[model samples]
Structures are given as C-alpha cells and as structure tokens.
Target: MRKMLDLLSLKLLRRIEIRYRLINSFLLVSMLPLVIAGIVAYRESSSASQEKVRIFAAELVKQVAQNMLQQIEKIESSSEELAMSERMQNALAGYYSKNPAERAAGHGEIIRLLLENYGSFEYVNQKYVLDRRHRIMDPQVFAQLGDGVARFAEDAPDMKGRPYWDVYSTAAGQNSVVMLRDILFKSNNRVAGTLFVGLRPLHFSRIFESVNLGYGSRMLVIDARDGHVIVSANAADGNAPESGLVVAVARNVAEGRDNFVSYRDGDNKQQLAAFAPVPHTNWMVVNITPLNALNTEVRSIRNKIIAIGVLCFILALVLSFIIARSISLPLKQLVGVMKATRTGNYLIRMDYEGRDEIAVLSQRFNEMASKVHQHNERLEELVAERTRELEQANHQLEALSATDSLTGIANRRRFDEALGGELRRAVRSQKPLALMMLDVDYFKNYNDRYGHLAGDDCLRAIARVLRTSSRRATDLAARYGGEEFAVIVAESDSANAMQLAENIRNAVAALQIAHEDSPFGCVTCSIGVTAVQVDEDMSTDTLLRLADVALYQAKALGRNRVALSDPAGATG
Candidate 1:
C-alpha cells in the first residue's frame, strides 16, 4: 500500500510539472512574438494615420486658401481697375485738392464715376471714398456703415495704390467684407484718397461651406499679420473656447508651418491641425479636426489586434492543457511498450496519432523492436528501402515548403534562391539575365468585388500562364507575393525581356476574368522588365530594385502594359 501511494504521488507531481512547463513554454513562445508584432503594427499604423491626416489637411487648407484668394483677388482687381482709370484718378485728385465745400462740390463726379463703374457689379454691396475730412462721398450709401468704414481706413496700414481687406459689422446690423486702397496722384505720388468697397458675408461663406472637416472640427481664416481670426466657418468668436483653434492658428501663423499636425488643441483632446497662407493677403486658412475622428481606422486596427491577441492567449492556454495531458498519458504507454519489448513481446506497438517529435521517436522504436530478429537477412534491404522512402518524403516536404500552395508556383523563398543562383551563373558566363515582375492591376478592387476564394482562383490562373510561358530549362517563374509574380530568364537581353513582358500582359488580359471593378472589364496585369549584363559588380538586390522601379512606372503610365527599365536605372 505504501508503494502504491508513493507511485500515485510521483505521477501526480510529474503531471503537474509537465502541465506547468507546457503552458509556460507555449505562452512564451507564441504570445511574446504576437505581443511584439501587435505593438509594432499599432505604432506603424498610428504613424501612418497621422502622416496621412497631415498631408490631407495641408492640401485641404491650401485649397481653401486658394479659393479665398481667388475671391479676394477678384475684388481687389476690380477695385484696382476702377481706381487706375484716368477719369477716376482725375476725379479723386480734384476732390481731395479742394476745401470741404469745394471737395463736396466735386465729390458728385467721384460718386458718379463710382456708380458708373462698380454700380452694376452685384458683388459691390458698398462703395465710397474716405478723404482728409473723414467725409463720406455717398452718405446714403454709407448709411449706418460710415463710422465703421472710416475707422477701418484709420486703423489700416498705408496702402500705396494697393488693396487691404477688413471684416466688420456696423451697429445698424450691416456686415461687410470691405477692401481699402489708396488712390495715388501721378505727379507727387501723394495719397489722393482711400477707396472703400464692401462685399456681402456670403462671399466668404461659400469658400468654407463645401469643406467637411469632420466632427468637432473648426475652420478659421486667421490674419497672419496680427494673428486674429477674420472669419470662421462653423465657429463663432464670442462663444468659442479660443483655446484649441486659436493656439494652433497662432503657432501656424508665427511659424509659417503649413503642414503642422498632431497636437493637443487645448480642449484636453488630441487634434490634427494644418494651415496654408493665402496669396496676395496676409492671412492663413487653418483647419483643425479631432484626432479621434481621424484615427477611427487606426483605432479599429488596434482593437482587432488586441482581440486577436486575447483570443490566441485563451486558445493557447486550452491547447496547452490538452497537449500536456495527451503527452503525459502517451509517455506512460510508451514505457509500457518498452517493458513488453524487453520481454521479447516485439509485436506490442504504441497507437499514437500525432505528427510531433515524440510520435516519430515512438514509431522508430516500434519498428526496430518488431524487426529485431524476424528478418535478419532482409534487414539490410528493408533499411535501404526505408532510407529511400525517407529521402523521398524529405524531398516532397522541401518542395512543398518552397512552393506557394495557393498559386502552385515557386514561392518567395524559392524565388530568392533562384535569383541568387542565376546571378552567380550569369556572372561566371558573362551573360545577360532578365527579370520580369508582374502585378494584377486593381487586385484589391477585384477582391472587394469578388470574394477572396475567387481571388485565389484568379491567382492560380495567372500562375498557370506563368508556368506555361517560361518554358526554358533555365527560366524560373515564381509567385513573389500576393497578386505579384516574378520571372527570371537566363541568357536574355532587354529587348527579349520586354517582349516576354508584353506577352505576359497580353495573356493576362486575355484571361477574360470578369472584373467589373477593372477599367478593362477583364482582369489585367502590369509588368516591369529589367535585364542586365551580369558582372562582378551586379547584385540580385540591385536587379530587384530596378525591376520594382520599372513596375511603379508601369503603374504610373497606366495599367495593362509593360515597362522596361533604362540603363540609367529609370523607366525606359
């Protein structure tokens, strides 16, 4: 009874240790790499999102600034045209050269010229001139806006026949975006008068109306000179917090950073901001959007990675427990089989169903024990046969590992090996070699239109074409990666490589795979061809790089065509 209890305790302790070791080994081996990959992917994806937002925001703000410049430039141009006229210049010099009564007497000519020139222009909501006496030439036109217009001219800088823009609202509820310019005399270059022309608020409204900056977004036209906001699209000056947009805009205007991005907008929320300077004016257009709003895709990727890691963790734990129990039980059985074989019961075998190392060891032991004395003469022949079988199995396994299972073509590992070997042989023979890289055009759209299973079939079909096309013994066709295939031709020059590439492109297009998403109404490919006379200086990496460059050129020029690399390592 003591022996039985001791044996039971020993088995229990061994099982516990085995379970602990298995769980620890599996978790460390699997989860550690997964955790590292998750972290790397998350950080890279985050950085990419931030960069994309920065570029997009910079472009959007630049477009807005350009639109605003176009509108303002039109107003400035019209006012300059009116002010540059000989009659208008004479009328201004005559009015400002006289006393208040005489000026008032000749001001009718100024008003008549203003009415005749800009009166018919619908955008000219308000037009007048400010003189030395602060008198309004058209009091009726100025109405409740006279004081505001005069103050603007007083506060504005000295304009020597140039336009200055201001945004204001009068006490009588008249709002105008007015342009101020000085009418200079031809002889003395003195300030004849200040021209005031106003536009409606809706004039600047259309510039910001069409832009969608997303939720919790803000768009402001900031004066670059003084860092004050001229107009806001979705924000109001009085009610706004003035912390987020104001701070970012202040930085943008101060630093002249048109591509500034990724900052806390002072609302305790992360935000992305960009600004662009408006041409012909000292103003900048700023666009600010919440980081979370722009990071939705990044967040989704992160969450999916986290979920996959968690699921893997749980599955690993459960699998560890199951594997531990299975191993422990099988080890006990294997011991029993060994004891029976020691007593000459060689027929006893372990009934294990696994492909692990333990299974292989047990199978070897079973075969050795069963054939120990039964076939002494035939043992040598049997050993020879098993050795041959093992070699054949190894060859099959190696081939499987080097080939892409989905496409039934040589995989990236095999492609790399082939390329290296081919370069060496070419260098020895001083012969030229050609490489072609082919990509299924618009494959992502194709997969989105069809299912992934169909995509796999499509790749297999392409691989069949590659297999048939490269008929030479020295030629190798490989699946470089998803939707990308490569071909290596020995003793080939650039012209032949290009011809082969064209053939491949045409063959792919002729497949007639219905791809509604593709422009050709059928599946097509783009091929990049590069051939170089192998020398001691040539490397596989350089060849692959050249081929990739040519591939990008093919994509740039248009798909469904082939591009060959030039001698200067550019597209031919």
Candidate 2:
C-alpha cells in the first residue's frame, strides 16, 4: 500500500501542467473564501429567523392568555355580584322556613336574577346555585352536574369562600371547565351555597380560532393546577390526542414563567412551542407549531443560497481556465518555435501581437532567427560582394510587396500588420496612438470625367501628399481601398493627430487637380481622426471603427473637412 501511494503521488506530480496546477490552486483558494462567507451568512440568517419565530410565538401565546383572562374576569365579576346580592342572601337565609310557598318563591326570584344579569354572555353555558346541603337551586335550569361535581364537593368539603376551577370530559366526549364559587350568608358571614358556572370548551376554542398560527399549529388552554387540557383547538383532524409532549410542555410552563422549547414527540415529529400563563387563573395558553411547517421559508432560503454558490463555483472554474490558458498558451508556442529553429528552420516566427513581456521576447527571437539565417547565407556563398547585391535586391522586393502598385505607398495588408504592432507598442509605453481615415471627395466623378489611367494618376498624386505629410518613421500612410486612405501615427496626442490630418487635407487641395463634375471645383479629401491612450483592453479593430465613424461625420458635415472621434463615445 505504501508503494502504491508513492507511485500515485509520482504520477500526479509528473503529469500535471503548470496551467492545471494554477487552475487548481485558484479554485481551492477561491472556494474557501466563498465557503466561509456562505457559512457565516447562513448561520446569521438562521439564528435571526429562529429568534423571530420564537418572539412571534411568545407574543401570540401572550395574546391568547390575555383574551382568556378577560373572559374569566367577566365570569368572576358576575359570580361576585350574584353572591353579594340581597335577594340571594335573603333566599339562602330563609331556605329552611316552615312556609313551603315562601321557599319556592325565593328560588324562582334567584333564577330570575341570573337570567336577567348574566344571560347575555355567550361563553356562560350553564349557571346554577347550590345550597349548604348540596341541593342545586332550580335543578331544571341546568344539565345534571354528574358524579364529577359530587366527587369534587366531597374532596373540598370546607367550601371556603373562594373560586375553584376544574376541567372534565362529558358523556358526549366534549370537554368543559367549571368555575365553582362559594356563596356566603351576609348576616352570619358564613358559606351558604355555591355558585357554579360551567363553560363549554367551544367558547375557548373560538378565542384560539381568532389567531392564525399557520398550518398544522395548535393552541391549548391547560389547567395549571392539575395539568389537564381545558381547551385544545386545531390539534388534529378530528379529536386531538393527549400526547405526552403536550402534558410535559404544560407542566413545564406551569412553573410560573413564559418560555419556548423545541423537541420531538413520541411519533418522531419535531415540534416548536411557546407558553404563557393566563392572568388570574391556574391555566396556561400554549402555542404549538410543527417545526417543518415553520421552517419552510428557511429551507427555501438555504436552497437558494446553495444554488448561488454552485453557480459562482462554475463561473470561477471558467475564469480559471481562461486565465491559465492566457498565460500557458504563449509559452507553449514559444517552445514549439524554439524547437523548430533548433532544427535549422529560421523562417519560423511568433505572430503574438500583445503588449506583454512575452510578446517582446517573441519579437526578439524572430529578429535573432533572421540574423542567424542571414549569417548562414553569407557563410555558404563565400563571395561577400555577390551577397551584398542579393541582399539589396531582396530588400527591394520586400518593399515592393508592401507598397500599393498604383499609389507607391503602403498597401492595406501592410497597414493592418503595422497597426497591430504600433498598438502593442503604444500600450507598453503608455503613449497615445492616432488613426486617420481619408476619402477622396468625388473621386468617382473624376473617373467618370477622365479615363481610368487619369484617375489612377489622380490617386497617386493624393497618396504622395499623404506620404509627405506623415514624415515620421513611426507614421504609416496606406491605401485602404479604392479612393480611401489610412494613416497611423504613434506617440502622438489628439491635437497632433488633428494637425497632421489638416495638413494632409490642405496638401491634397493644393495639388490643383481639376474636377469639373465635382461640387468642390477642385479635388479635395475628407479626413477622420481618432486618437487613444492605448491600453490592453483596446484593440486594433476598435481603433479602426472609431476612425471610420469620424470619417462618416466629416463627410456628413461637408467635403474636405477633418472631424475627430470622441474616445469616450467609442464602444469596446
């Protein structure tokens, strides 16, 4: 295994190119920063989202608690008024009187008072008064108290003048809360009867319904004293099961503090819950929401972030390939060219026309190859005088090839090659380069009036003027096409370029070439000038296009005029 690992390492080190290594390094370093930023952002967003959910749930639970307290307060207030009533005290005071008709009238009067004062409340489902002997007053007014109330009375036999709350399920499987209050006889200041107010869980359910706790969330009112659920709304499809989680949360909240928790239930479902105690009662309002339901938005944001990260990684990979190729391809070509030259092939040359140091090296290499080829030719010929004659003839042939046959000036091919070189030089030196495109005004009319030979002579005269105007070795005057000429000036500003263009225009007009059909009466040329402070992003084609645009503007304004292109307006 050790030998195999060594062999794998050797193979990787031997086969990987500098380009691939650079790309791998760039991707590794770039991905770490991106990953770190993504993790930090995700952690911050998740923490913030969790905190917001907790706050919302706690506030909702508090609101529900407030509403329940209000309802309970109304009931307690009504119960207190009835207990303190003079008629209720007088009735209980005369309950054992020998006059049987007086006892019946007192019970009827108490029932009439209950219906008149407390009947309008929607949450008051049942109301009744119990005497000291556990005999319910007006028994026909309410449903049976059932065996639960009898057991409750036996448990609390003292019947202290205080309110007691209990939750119990009826025979119909509906839950209800019963508020039992002790009634006192005012004269003796002792417990005389009990005022019972039974509330259906449906009334509390309506309170929960008023709040929107999202999907698959529930609200419960729990009896803090007994850990019993008094009211559970939207807990399930039909009847909500009294799960262990619900009981645990209720008991935990009954410790007299508002709190929130996240836990999994017996069914392996994640739950989020917040609880608050209802004021003036031994009850707590709990808002329980499923974790998956609340985390939907969070999950979506996570997925979107992951997608963006993947797209960024892909873009980085593409950029790495582009940057690596830009560096490696030139070196590879140089290696090939050097190998060719080693085999006695001196004609091979690098065509890279960039402002980088590599391009400069390639140009020097080509120059060295030319010198070597010339030296070898001189050594083989042995006659120095004949070699000199042949060299001069070669130079003449080279010059003729670059010149336009009719105009005796540089041709379009030579002009294009020189422009590329000059553009590279300008970038390296950080100097300006200017281009001028000129057209002979009404030259076609001249050809129509004179013969093709006369027209050729006319072009030759115009080319001479352009050539004389561009006197510097760095400047080039070329016949771009029929009746159009181009000039390239290096290390010059816009002002200098405009001056040279005007000089060429004036020189052409000074030729005094007659054109009878022309609008100008004499032959003239329109010039378009464009100058640029060269940079890597600017190309030869871009400069040509800008100069051409200026030429069009000059023609549009009038003939034989010079128009300069705005560099800021030029496109890439």
Candidate 3:
C-alpha cells in the first residue's frame, strides 16, 4: 500500500484544495470521541428505562397469575361444598349398593344433585365421578370420554384424597383441563367417590378477556404438571405456521419462579419475558413483551446519535468528493468496465481517448478482456459436453433404482407403478389384465439344506423364465420380494394367463437346479394366475390378492404346479 502511494507524484497529490483536505481531516479526528460520549449517555438512559419496564412487567404478570389462581380456587371451594353436602354424600355411598333398584336410584340422584349444585353439564364434555372401587359412576357416559379418562381414574387411588390436575387435547380438537378431587364422607372422614371436572379451553378465555396487552405481547398459562399451555393470550395460534417456535419458547423459559428474562420470540423480535407461579396449583403464567414496545426512550436516543453521525459523514463525504472528482471520473469508468467483464461480458471495453495513466490501463484491460472472451467460448463447449455426460449418468442411476439388483427385473416399487398405469390403460382400451404370483416351492428348506447363495441362484434362474414369458410391451415382470415374483399381462384372458403360468412352471422345473430338500429333487416354483376383465371397480391390490390366493393353493396341493383362480377367487 505504501509503494502504491509513493508512486503517486507530489504534483498529483497537491491538485486537491488544501481547505477541503483540512476540513475532512478535522471531522475524522473529532467524530470518534463525540460518538463515544453519545453511546455512553444512551446506554445509561436505556438501562434505566429497561429496568423500569422489566419490574413493571413482572408485577403485572404476577397480578394476572394471582387473579387466575383465585378463579381456580373457586372451583376447589365449590367441590368442597359438594363434599360436605349431606344429600350428595348419601347418594355417592349408595352408588355402590348391592340392590339393583337402589343403585339405579342413587345414580339418578347423584346426577340430579350435580346438575343443580355444580354446573357439571356446562362442561364441553360431561364431568365424571369415580367410586372408591375405581369404577366410573356413570357407565353409559364412558363412551363419551375416552381412554384418557380411564388413565386419569387409575391414578385417583394413588392420589389419596388430594387434588390432581391434568390437561389433554380431545378428539374434538378442543383442549380440556381435568381436575380430580377425592370427596370424603363426613361420618367417618374417610374417602368417598372422587369428583372429576373438565374445564374447556374457553374457560381460560375469561381470564384473558380483561387483559389488554399491546401488540407483540403474549401470555400463556402452562400446566406445570406437564409443559402444555392451557390457555394463551396475544399468543400464536396453535395451528399457525410459527406454532413450533412459539411452543419451543414457552417450554424453553424457566418455570416455578417470578423472574424476568430477555429472549427472542417467534417473529424474530426481542422480548422481555416474566414468569409467575400460580399459587397452590401445578401451573404458571408467562408474559412476553416485545422489547420494541418498551424501548421508546432508547430508540429516540439512538436516532439522535445516528442523525448527528450522518450529518458529520455527509459533510466529510462531500468535501472529499470535490477534492478527488477529476481523478475519480476516469477511474470509475474503468471500474464499471471491470465489473461488466467479471460478469462474463468480456466484449465490453472502456472508451478512454486521453494519453494519461488511465489510457494505458484501459489498453491493457481491453487486451485481457479479448483473451478471456476466447477462453470462455472454449469453456462453454466443454461444459456442455460434460453436462450431457452427467445427464446420461443420472438416467442410468434412475433405471438402476427401479431395477431389482439380483434378478435385473422390475422391483416391487416399479411393479406397483406399472400395475396402476397398466390397469388404467387396460380399462380404457377394454382389454383383459392378468396377474400371476409365483413363489419358489420349499425355498426356505432349500436355503437351509444348500445355502443362501444357492437359493439366490435358483430365484435368478426362475426370474429369467418369467422375464422371457412377458414378451409384449404391455407386460411387466417384477421380483415382488424374496423368492417371490409377479407379472402383469395386459390384453390377455384367464385361458392365456393359465397357459403362461404353466409354461413358467415347466421352465423352472427345466432349470434342474439341485434342491435336495425338495420332494421333486430339483428347484421348481408354484405359479398362481388370475386374469380379470379390466373394470373400474377392481384395484391393483384386488388382482394381486386373487393371484396370491391361487398361489397358496398351488403350494398346498403339491410343490411344482400351476393354479388358476377365477375373478371370484375360487382356485382351480
């Protein structure tokens, strides 16, 4: 860099006005300290404002959590009232009566009392009561609630008269908060039946209704038992695209404390979050307020600093431009041509008529651009040829993916794709479609006696026969699975299909591959053929199932034979 500056003659450096140079120098020397002072002032102010906002948010969320907890306590108190009621206790005790008529009357009385005192029917789903025996009181209502209720009930005995809280997402797509309380008998103070109440997600909506948090502020009531959010306000919709991020943030925040933290939310906005525990319940309230909403004073200070800096920059920039204008014009033109050349526009040339240093630079640049143009033309042709070769390799890879590695026939994936297309074609053209399933008879025993390698060779020899039998363009032969193959023949009837299967059977028997485990003393396959007149009602699986049934019959009757099944699936 020093060498380059030394090359610039003193006459060239002296061409600019000295006043502009001095002014630019002064701005450079003074601006750094000014910026540092402004930053210090802004940081002090912003820190104070942020602390204020954090404390305010913490208190606000704490109050909200306490209020929500009070509403829940009301439910517990109401349940207590029911537990202390004489009539309700008698009805619950009589629920386990041995007499059928008394049990019926007790069940009716419990229902009537719950409807009048507790608003059990107001639940999105009916509330439940489980007797001391762990049997649900309302047997008919069991179908309404699902296995989740059974699981909740199973835990009731272990709770031992304490309250349990849980949340579940229902089949109806609503979330419910289930609270279980063990009701006690007043006479002996022993435990009676347990009362279960389900609060719908909308019940939490009441807690959120009065909260008028500003935009970008979110609040969630998370069940501490599990990290599931019972209700959320100013929160991301569970079905929204950003729900995963929202859930992650809620779970990522620490629980069981009254604390504040700075975090980034789903929208990529910085947020100040506060957590407050709901008293006496396994839940907490989370408040997330975007930093932008609380950073008004800080933003103003930042803007003032930026404005002062920008003005200083503009003043220095204008003076520097005036001093260098004459030298920069020609250089900027050369830079433009260089940029165009980098983009492969090598034909672009700088137009410089003066005999200055720039003229010499332009001359050399033109020469280099011409040489690059020639080289690039050759590179284009080479790239095209290589691209064609790469395309051919990709095609080969695709074919290999669909072909069976051992038998070199279509794999099951290819067979399924072909069958669907061929079935459509056969139906459209009014042609018969025949499907054949072939399994090597006693193949597992053969593998046990000979070896897996011998079994593989035996199957490969049989694949050759089926592949040869499928001679038409509409025919597809595939290795369905190990020691099993299938063929789809278009434009063929049952008679033709049976003939093909018989030929395939004889060909496998002709292989004369030694199989000492076989009754026939050689490797052979049982073929099952099913041909159907293509109809809209039939599917690829239906045809395959029929052929498989016939193949099973062939294996059952004897080791090496062809069996045919009618469309009705009766084997012959």
Candidate 4:
C-alpha cells in the first residue's frame, strides 16, 4: 500500500511540473509583449488615418472649386464677346426703331449671329435675346425663356455692359444659372436689351460626381451672395440633397473667409467642413465629411488589434497544453516500456505517433526490444529476410526509373538503350531485325477535342495494345515520345514485320475510341515498318531515320495504314 501511494504521488508531481513550466514560458515569451505592441500600434494607426482623411477632404474641395472657376470663366468670356459685338449693338438698336421692316431685318441678322455661335461654349445649353418690351425674336428661344426673361430684363439693365449670373427656376421647374449680359447701343453707349445664356446645374454637380469622399460626405456649390445651395451631391448615393453643413460654411465664406471648420450638428454629430471660393464669382465649393466615419475606421482597427491579441492568448494556452501533454505522456510511456523490458518483457512497445525527436527515440527503443525477442529464435532467418527486403527495394527503384509515368511502358532513355543492345545483338548474329514506329493520327487534334486527362487515357490504351502485340520474349516495346511508340522485333523478315504492324493497327482500331477529328471516325494509328539485315555499316540511328521516313509516308497516304521503307542505300 505504501509503494502504491508513492507511485501516485510521483506521477502527480510530474504532471504539475510540466503544467507550471508551460504556463510560465507562454506568459513571458508571447502574451505580455503582444499586449504592449498592440496598444502602441493601434494608437499610431488611428492618428495617421485621421490625418489622411483631413488631407484628402481638403484636396477634393480645392479641386472642385478650381473646376467651378474654370466653367465660370468660360461663361464670362462668351458673355464679354457678345457684349462687344457690332452686329449685336445694331440688332439691339433696331429693336426700338420706328419702322417695322428694320425690326424684321434686325431679327434675321441676330438669329444668324446666334446660330453661328451655338456650339461656341460647352456649358451653355440655350441662348435667349430679350428686349425692354419683353419681346423675344425667336419662337424656339421664347418657349424656353420661362420667367427668367422678365427677371433678367428687370435686373440686367442696371448692370450696363457687365454680366450678371443668378440661379433661377425654368418653366420646366428645373433650376439653372442664367448669365445675363447687357446689350448696349454703340451710338449712345446705353443698355438696349439683355442676352440670356442658361447653364445647367448638372454641369457643376458632375464635377464632384467621381470624387469619393467616404461615407455620409457631401459636395455643395453655394451662392456666396445669399448662402443658398446652387448644387449639392451626396457622396453616399450620388444624389442631390436639399440642406446640409454647406449652408453654415457658405455664410462664413461669404464673410470673406475661406477655411476649414469642425463643428457639431443638430443631431450632436461631429462634422468637418471645408470651403474654397470660385474665382471671379460669388460661388463657393464646400466639402462636408462626418468625423464619425473616420472614427468608425479607427474603431475597426482597434477591434482587430484586440481580437488578434485575444486570439494569441487563446492559441498560447492551447499550444502550452498540447506541448505539455505531448512531452509528459510520451516520456511516461517510454519509462513504463523500459521498466517492462528490464524485467525480460521484450515484446513491450510505445504507442507514440509523432515525428519529433521523442518519437524517434521511442521507435528505436521498440526496435531494440523486437531484436532482442528474435535474437535466439532465428538469426539466420533474420539475415535472409533483410536480404530479400533489399532486393525487392532495388527492383522497385529500377522499375520506376525505367518506366514511363504516364503510359506505363519503357521511357525514352530505356528505349534508346534497348535499341542499341538489339542492334548490336542482331549484327553479331547476322539476323534480321525489324523496327516499327507508330503514331496516333492527329493526336494534337484529339487532345483539343478531349482534355489532357482523356488524352493520357488514350495513350495508355495504345501502350497496352503495343505491349500485347509485342509479347515475345525477344521483342521490345517502348514509348518514344508524346503520342509516339516504337517496337523492335528480332528474327523477323519484311513479311513478318508487316504482319505484326497490321496486327497492332487492327488492335487499336478495335478499341473504337471516338475521334471526330480523324477521317476514320475513331481513333487509329499510323505504323512505319522497316526490316534490315544487320551489317558492320548499319547503325541504330540510320535504322531509326528509315522508320521515320516510312511513318511520314503512312501519314501522307491518308493515315490509319502501314507503310514500308526502303533500305538506306538501296532506294527505288
């Protein structure tokens, strides 16, 4: 009872020691440093992301403002040209003339001038000419002028030759900006009428359409005069919104300040806004990005860092447990096995399943016990068994090295050695030898119709047929290359060689493999047969060349047939 109690106590102490060591090592080597690094990395990444968002938003607003300024400058240039036109001055003066014919002639000349300059600007969608009497000459222009003509006639007359740009609703209820240039009479230098050119708000909205400003962001074009939004684009859905943070930014910009602002909205949500004034116009481009969007990104990174740290902690615990069990259990098993072996039990073994040094030691111990068990029983038999195992291993290695992996026949290297040996034997005996080269008819087309795997199956089937046909002990068959095979038959004349070639062709045809690409309506082979009497002048290479020539002939003669070749020097 005391001995049993001491054994249990020793086992428990070993387990506790292993557990404590693994836990302590994990805490010092992995967990503590990971926690510290995760905190530092999260802080640095959050700051960099916030700075990137600010810089991106500032650049986008500036680009939008610059694009708007260019459009405005184009409109201003077109307006100034029409304001200085001599024909325009004459036409405006004629509108107030006493004679009806003068007004009719002036109307025709003005229409011609407008038609010539119709596509002169890219942004102008429509042009209108209005007189103080609110009369428009062109009926097409009259239909589109809407209430904008009355508004322009009232306000534009005060500007003399200067251009006035204002956003107004058209007759179709679409809002657009109308550039009204005062047409003056050159005789008295007084305003005679106004030229109205309507610009689509879509042109300005499209400027920010392709700019991605993250989630819940918006781009706005505001009238600096009254803090009114002329155009707005919601970055989330690419749609126009009515009111946003642009109103406050525009008011600030109108007070002669162009800058960035951060403030809270009615919902108490933090927002970032930037303002840039369009040059030579009372317009400002404003970009408003929500701060919570950046915070969401930062929070995502923080969660990821925390998740990785937690995952590391869990993995460390699991690995420590696995390592402890792996080491302690195997060592205990080895000790028990050793104790049993010391008591004359040579059949005991350890059931360890791993590839580490411990597993190797356990395997060697089992081997030692197995040897000791068989030591006196059959020493001679053990030597014989080892010799047989070595011989079998050598045979397997030789077969693998010589055989084709795909076709299960002799490979090219083996084929070359066989051919040389056969030629030398045939020369020494002065006996007749025949070489036959076979090829699948249009095998490339077969591979194209089927897949490469099917092609491999076809080659294997062909190899089996060749092996069966050349089954004599003296005959050699081999895979020469892709889709090509060769056979060497000893003690055969031309007649016997032709018979063997015909047998192979018929066997392949009997397989009936589908070949839509071949004229035979199934897979077939072309065989080239050459029989020669061995001599000192003959060589293996020369014999192969003759067989190749015959193979070409067989393919040229509408394939699926055998052809015979003449000797090297004895041509037809």
Best by TM-score: 3
**lDDT per residue, candidate 2, 174-220, as tens digits?**
65587888888777778888877778777778887778767457788
Q: Which pairs clash inside model 3?
A: none
Report model 4's TM-score to 2 decimal places.
0.42
How many clashes show up per model? 0, 0, 0, 0
Clashing pairs in 4: none
What TM-score does each of the candidates earn?
A: 0.42, 0.42, 0.47, 0.42
lDDT of 4 by residue, 255-276 (tens): 8754776766556777777777
Which ten contiguous residues of candidate 2 have the minimum total lDDT?
Answer: 5-14
Q: By descending lDDT, how would the candidates be arranged? A: 2, 1, 4, 3
Question: Candidates sorted by TM-score, descending order?
Answer: 3, 2, 4, 1
Q: List the residue pairs that clash in candidate 2.
A: none
Candidate 4 has an lDDT of 0.76
Off by over 4 Å in 3: 1-322, 335-344, 353-368, 371-375, 569-572
In the range 278-352, model 3's lDDT, one tens digit per residue, is: 876767777766777666666677668756766767766654554455457668889988987767799998887
Where does candidate 4 have its weakest 10-residue lDDT segment?
A: 235-244
